[model samples]
Target: MENILIPLMDNELSPRFDLAPEVLIISITRETSAMGTLSERVINFETPSAEAMYRLVMAENIQTIICAGMEKEVYEFLKRKGIKVLDNVCGPVDPILEAYLAGHLSSGQNYF
Candidate 1:
């Protein structure tokens, strides 16, 4: 299974990374043909810095993260950790997640 995390704000993608407090955590099997059997949970935390968020993700063994914006340095830091960080994604969280599971989400997508 691949663990995914999406920073959220009132059910939409958070306007910015640092501002996101509640993150929707999802676990989907590696076979990403469709929305696989998903198990989801919520984790509320401040700061999106690689230093802090890194620990949380590591703890959960997260494989991917879909978020709005992030510092280039932090992005690189996570990438180096072997975690896929999809940045510059904007839209309501549900549609975003659906599109992602459907295998079409990419950086700089604005489904607003």
Candidate 2:
């Protein structure tokens, strides 16, 4: 399975309480040794539109999305397209994803 993990600026990854300026979209390919790879770098150019973000994810062939927060419309669209969405995950991406794969991450309160 391939999954994307984004690190937020607060809650664990950093002391600041704001989403990272740039969203890091990672593609994790589960294989013999759990290969973690970076597919692309998505830079939100002054509040990018939901459609643009969605398109970027599609272009990178991401199956799952992990982020701090997302608009409801975008989330719904991704869900309809068969993409799993995980929200309220604030911390360093790699460790958070590792926790998720190990079944230690849980869906927290909804913020969108």
Candidate 3:
């Protein structure tokens, strides 16, 4: 199973990563050519903070992050931690997650 995190603003991907108020964490399992969701949960922050987000990511053991935009430092931090960062993705949460499961999502792709 792979643990993925997506920063959210309302129902869509947050335009700015550090400013996102909520984050969705999902666990998916891939078998053969099929993918299935194992679990999903949302974490709401009292205030947006990159440090807090990073702590959650570490605590949750997130393997991948699907987000719209993030600072260079934050991106580098995740990379250094061996986490996959799919930046610049824009779309509603459902479609974006579906596309990712299908292996069709890419950075800088706008689905909105």
Question: Worst ten-residue run, lDDT, model 3?
Answer: 29-38
Best by TM-score: 3
Off by over 4 Å in 2: 5-20, 33-47, 109-112
Off by over 4 Å in 3: 31-35
Query: What's the best-to-worst order under lDDT?
Result: 3, 1, 2
lDDT of 1 by residue, 13-106 (tens): 8867656778889998755554357889988876554555667788999899899988788788789999998899998988899888888999
Would you list the clashing residue pairs of candidate 1? Answer: none
For candidate 3, write residues 1-112 as lDDT tens digits: 8999999999899998888999999988766566464689999999889889989999999999999999999999899999999999998999898888878998988888
Give the per-residue Cα lDDT of candidate 2 at 59: 78
Query: For model 2, how many clashes?
Result: 0
Relative to the true structure, candidate 2 reaches a TM of: 0.63
Clashes of 3: 0
* Higher-TM-score candidate of 2 and 3: 3
Q: What do the candidate models score in CA lDDT, each in turn?
A: 0.83, 0.57, 0.91
Model 3 residue 84 distance off true place after TM-score fit, in angstroms: 0.4
TM-score for each predicted model, relative to the true structure? 0.86, 0.63, 0.93
